[model samples]
Target: MTGICIQATHRRGGFDLDVQAGFSDGRVTAILGGSGAGKSTLLRLVAGLESLKTGRIHVGGRTWADAAAGLHLPPQKRSVGYVFQDYALFDHMSVAGNIAFGIKGSRKERGREASRWCERMHLDGLAERTPDTLSGGQRQRVALARALAPDPDILLLDEPFSAIDTHLKRKLTDDLKDVLRDRPRAVLMVTHALEEARTVADDIAVMAGGRVMRLGTASDVTDDPRAHEVAVLTGWRNLLAVGWMSGNRMGGAWGAVDLDHPAPVDAAWIGIRPERIRIESQPGAGLPAIIKSVRDFGPVREAECVLGCGATLTVHKAWDTPLPAPGTRVGLVLPGEHVRPLTEGRAMAAVDRCDARGRQARA
Candidate 1:
């Protein structure tokens, strides 16, 4: 295979992971999901840190793991670079020594390579410092530099930004993006942050409940996540149960929306992104609803509204827009093109409203 192909079933404790995904060279594929969704375990499976109960992993036409062939490569035997969530750097060694440990050359040559990475990772003067003396972002850079020092064929990152401060996350993410731009290798990153996955990855694999829920380009997956679990993970804040009401119309907890065409037969929920919802003050403008509350979030304002069915919907609007006071009557307009139909499944229970934390609550 020209790219990294993985078809693996792994069991660890109470969790079972069965995923099939492919990642192309020179591209970053983010395995995105919430905690306990099996994102990190999938990364470990690729790195040989976890054994596969069944299936195969082929990287660059070489079989790294194959249950059928009874072949499983050790971590050191596979050409892979891994940056753990903790940025596992040697506290006893200087930054230069830690990075040089991975290089296979002699002392002089290793020193020269380590110096090059220090400059590349913007640690030019800090190379002599120990990891304990460095900041979170600095330690992260050192971990990445050390991983890349060996020139591995694959790069694996597990929540690369979890340890960094909120103020420094964007800058560090941008720095990592610049580092991966021209590198010709398959990079698999595991993260729960949707924005980080969208910002740093060329492709995204949505992992949830120990399976790959969706896989495609970042835009494709984020723009039109058709599955219920996929939609919720990708920022679809309002998911209401719907039932056939009339021609071209479907009634749900949030009232009804008139679609251009008939609703899908299998659609059990109507999903709307918080930013896609529009509130109109006119009595008969659209679906009837009452403004419950509004909060300012700097760039945007979040408003909570209640429908006639007693269900609530969250709407995000530009901060500059006129803010509606609490208890005011308003109409919700779910644009046909912006509304998404979510399929029904055994694991997908009907969600009537979003909780205070902006998560769906099953009624």
Candidate 2:
């Protein structure tokens, strides 16, 4: 029942944001989007950095911004903590100094608060060190500790791990995840990194063109959605134009293939992850394709094949599998259940169909 609720409409510079979204407390919600998708703008609106043009923005039972009632709480007035994109640490401030900046109390009390967060963030010995001397990971932890030191009910993190190197980023992400798990406050972290979202977030909101196009749990968004839009963001390699066929089948690049369910009305295309594609060695086991290209990438070998329909699609095989020479004809094992029809049965229609199919399948 307690959460960050938002319904707002803000427009600027050819970008229009009109979304009504909610994120429960005691969870981390990652807003995933591409550059210029208004991810930061939404965060700013929640943080009170930007005024709400219309609708309400509420956090943890308190109304932060309600344009209908002309109520707008300034960022400083609201109980919120923010970790900026670059960490935003003061060059002159030591780690402890940065942490104590947002804490309200006597010097001794603030020092105690800072010390508490330092310990939680695994920054005991580095308290006296300035930002310039610390590594990117340390600086990030210090910034996080500083924001969280105040014990704000709502926390906003703007791509906190984007600047760090790969090795340090993973380590820092694990540390940050632990820090967040220990605390059950409402959190919203915005990032363009899919792996980070998959690793860190409990919930995900897929954003595009200044709005959340889809909202679901991490698994729902990543592993199961299967729609072309969500699939594209989460590693699907092929999204080919197609036409619906009879008997719950689709006609696309590789010709007519069966579907697990009825074809969605108005479907414009079909989606398939390259990894889901299987290359068969036999002559007549499956759809015919000829090897066209190959690339070796350690764990998996990627090969593109030209289908009889004259369309090229990529396929993945385990590194141990023998590679087919160029022009060698191969059969494709594209499962019906795994192939996702795109732009079909979206909105409430999809939900209704899903529920009905779920019941029918269970029955």
Candidate 3:
């Protein structure tokens, strides 16, 4: 009742979105998903840009939309601040003007508010500059300052960093993180990057195929993504479809995983992070694999290994470690604690399957 509650459904073309989620005040929730996951649509529904003809949308106990009562507030009427992917800054307006645009008050009051935001966002000297003269990061700060200027009850961000350069993201992320801290509002951010979500959001809601497959604290969702979709979205690059299972041993095309305990009865996939794999020179220490290739990536070294069953596994180690020669035989130790079992029917692994199909068609 003190934050935002959403139970909404919207259909367009062949896709349907049905989401029921709640965000507490002063917490930031990241909607993590790939393209077409309905992340943006959910944001639109919350901002009143999209209609919910049969569901409810509430912000701090204020009903923005209630289809049963045939009530849907327009976007302008809702206390929401939206930052679009493009930033949507008015090119003609100065930085100060943009930040003060949302505040409805006397000229002096608006100026005073704008100056405060400019200082808060570290855009103090650029107040008089137009949007075209600002850097991408500067423009982003401007957008954020504008959105927060009016102090709305809910903040909606759509791909806020998609357009930023990779090198600049770390600082901007820190800045945004600092801005959101202790802010008494429900902030909803949509992003496909797990690092961004984990670093910024208090909670993460994993979305796929138009629904939230998983939602929990950032650590809980990322550390052990139980669903295949959640695993994929949370940076589990190695997922093996189950070929067979008997007791604690589960065999797939990639090899067999011997769990320390009984496997989940409905397990359909096994996932492990590349960094979780340990390579041993002794053959009998663990599963036998042959190093196929090795690549140096400055801080990290990556190796592609093929198991005895011809399934490929990627292993990552520190760059300072001695690299294994290609074609060298090694034992891969997949610690039981790092292995994740993704249950059947709960995950929509359609993204990978569709990609594989497209690759086949292209070939």
Candidate 4:
């Protein structure tokens, strides 16, 4: 299947976007990063909403941009469906009217297409409602239907679930996965939530400082050494900056630890999910820590522990598990193989070699 290939540079305000990335067809490719990572800029470039200073963009083997040749396609002619973060429905139009607005066809044909999308989006009974009358989820569904009704070659979503309430957000996420499942066009979705990316994307691209740091299949990107930084950005709580202390082992301020594979001394960083930390009543090979605080999160409990050397760690456990009271002493056990060594530095230069290998696998 033909996919999207983009390599471009653009300058906006104080930021500069120097991005080169490819998206696959028939799969959800999630663009993940922090606030200023240029996720939206990448989407705009692909959609022809932003002008390119250099480079080219191709969708399904068709050239939409070529700066050197002075060829630039306008947004309306790009054949791309865009769903904005705010759900951008027309306040003046009914749900059905909104979906049928820009579609090119006879009135009856447009009505049929609108009705089909409304049914697919579970909005059959709400066809006559205006934007103000629908719930947040319903409005988002309407916006999606409007974007897809035109039958574009590619789909672009910019934080599509960011505006909903927490409870409804989960349901919308599941609903979106189902909607995008059988779509024939390529889809690129931008979000900072790692769990959301995991749920909806087959491949992932992690961007920072207007450049893609890593891009590959979800599992491969998440398993990469550089993924430690991505995990931290995604809200991972416990990341230990450890390095090789001996053969097949590493050492952090906490203690000496073993690894499934040896990593370069300069490139090693150990990471352990908070849930993997086990608190033992007896002395063990793990680090000795003092309980600092305990907080409850629905069905789970998180304990903050301070090691003797002053490093803080969060341990996650079931609410029913026996937990140490604040001020009690405890021990921490981290699995050996969980440690990952990443390349040094955060600059784009450091990611070049690693990203080259990553791009090959993804392609």
Candidate 5:
């Protein structure tokens, strides 16, 4: 019940944005989508950079903006913090100076306050270094420390890890998550990386075409997805257009997937996460498939399978499992419980696709 509520609508040119979501108390809510999905726009509106033309925003019992009431607080008056993607630290200021810049106390008091953040962010040694002399990870740490210097009730981060080197991002993300978890404030982070959102956030909000398409816990959204578009966007590998599905049985490009539970009426697509796919050891136990390709990624092996039922699917297996090479014949099985219907009747028409064998199925 305690956290932030945001509702906004803004239309400019061909793109229109409408989002209604919340950041729960002591949790991180990630806004995930492709470019131009309005993730950054929502943050800007909450920070008072964008005009709130038709919505209300309330955080921790404070009304930041309510367009119907003709009230809007400037960013200076709002108790909020923002960490920009590009680490917008003053080029001339040292690390300590940047942290102290957000403090509102006298010069001496500000210096004392900044020292605490330096210790918290593990920047004690780098406090005297300017941004130009620091590495990408160090620069991001400075940006994070500055954002938290004032102890705002809500924190907004716009892809804070995008600029850091890939080798250093995990450590920096862990450092930032520790601070956010221990403090337990309302946080909204915008990132396009699904791995980042799964690793860093408690709740996930998926945006598409200027609207919030799905909102739920990370596991729930990533596991089933429950929609074709969401499943595809989240990197699901085995989504196929099916002609029809009903209780425990579905007929489509992959023939019939004997599900453990009843599927939703008028199903369009059937999907399973790549990790859930398994290579059957016994002959004739699963679907007959021809291996199309196998890709190795150090720890995991990805295999593309063309099912005898005409549909093609991808399966992920561990590197040590010893997979057959391309063009090998094998039996494939989709674990019944993991395979679920991905779409309702509305999207049935949008996903028509031909299986590998030229049989048409709804995508």
Candidate 6:
């Protein structure tokens, strides 16, 4: 099956974007970044809603834009499907009508295509309902169905789950994943939520400053040495400044810890997901800390601790786990493998290191 490849330049506000990306067929590639990272701008460029200053876009082996060659395809000419964040359904159209709107065929053929999409999206029972009467998740399903009914070669989703409630987001994400599985189309989704990206994407692109800072499989990018910024953006809780390092052992302001493997020198930050941290009643080859607070976040409990050296860390435990009360003394154990060494300096510097290393490894 064919996929999508884009190298585009566009201007938005005072920011200018120079982005190049490729989406593989039958896979979900998530565009992950912080706010104002130009994710939406990239989506608009792919959808043909924004004019490109210089670049090219190819979908399913067809060139849609080639600025140097003066080839630019309009939105209608490009076989792309777009599902907006707001569920931009037509107020005058019912669920079935909306799904059938973009399909080009006889009335019977359109109706059959709409019904198939409605069934696939679980909107059969609500086919007669108008957009206003549908719940948020239902409306989102309708929007997705409408986009898919046209049978486009590429799918572009711009924060597709942003408007849904937290409780429903997971379910919708799973549903969407099931619907897109094994389909011979390139999928690009933009989301600020890291958990959402983690759940739905096979590959991830971390964007910042109007450019893609890193792009790889989820594991490759997340495990990259320069992915501290991505981890921080993904809600990683414990980021301690590194004080020193000797061989495979590292010392931070909080405490000294050992790494399972050797890391490059000049490490600036130590990243540990709070959930990976463990707390014990007594100091057991770990840092001694005083519990500062216990926060309840429904199914999980979080204990905030301050080490003797003044550095703070957090540990997540099941709500049922017996947690130490505030003011209690505890030991914070960071296993060797969980201590990720972060590269020093700005975000792009790390990306440069990662790219260089990748090239050397490939060579």
The digit string of per-residue lDDT tens for model 5 on 1-363 reads: 357777767767767777666667688878888899888888888898887768778777677888888888999888778999887889799999999988998999999888888887788888888888988888888898899899888899999889988888788778777878865678889999888888888888777777777777888778877877677667787887878766689877566779898888756888887888777745786777889999988998899989876678888888887888888888887888888787742232222122222222311
- Model 4 C-alpha lDDT versus the unseen true structure: 0.81
Task: List, residue by residue over 1-363, the lDDT tens digit for candidate 4.
Answer: 467777778889989898777777898999999999999999999889898999888787788988888989999889999999897889899999999986889999999889988899999989888988998899899989999989889999999889888888777889999999998778999999887888888888888888887877888777653645666665667776674468777776777667778666565566677887778767664888999999999999999999887889899999888798999888887776665655443643423221321221244
List residue ranges in candidate 5 displaced over 4 A. Answer: 281-284, 308-310, 344-363
In order of listing, the candidates' clash counts read 0, 0, 0, 0, 2, 0
Which window of ten consecutive residues has the lowest lDDT sum in model 4?
A: 352-361
Could you give candidate 1's per-residue lDDT for residues 7-48 as a string of tens digits? Answer: 779998989988766777788988889999999998888889
| Residue 176, candidate 1: C-alpha displacement in angstroms | 0.9
Query: Model 3 over residues 1-363: C-alpha lDDT tens digits?
Result: 367777767888888987766677788989999999999999998898889856787777678888888999999999789999979999999999999999989999999999999998999999999988989999999999999999888899999999899999988888889999968888999999988998889988899888888777898888878887788899988788888899888887666778877877778888898999889997788788899999988999999998877778899999988967999999998887788888753543322111211111110
Stretches off by above 4 angstroms in model 2 are 344-363
Cα lDDT of candidate 6 equals 0.81
lDDT on C-alpha atoms for all candidate structures: 0.84, 0.79, 0.85, 0.81, 0.79, 0.81
**Can you list the residue pairs that collide in candidate 4?**
none
Question: Model 6: per-residue lDDT, tens digit, 97-186?
Answer: 999999999999998888888888888888888988999999988988898888888889999999999999899899888888867788
Cα-based RMSD of candidate 1: 7.4
Worst 10 residues of 6 by lDDT: 354-363
- What range of 10 consecutive residues in model 5 has the weakest lDDT sum? 349-358
Model 1 TM-score, all chains together = 0.91
Flag clash pairs in model 6. Answer: none
Deviation in Å, model 4, residue 26 alpha carbon: 1.0
Q: Give all TM-scores, in the order shown.
A: 0.91, 0.90, 0.91, 0.90, 0.89, 0.86
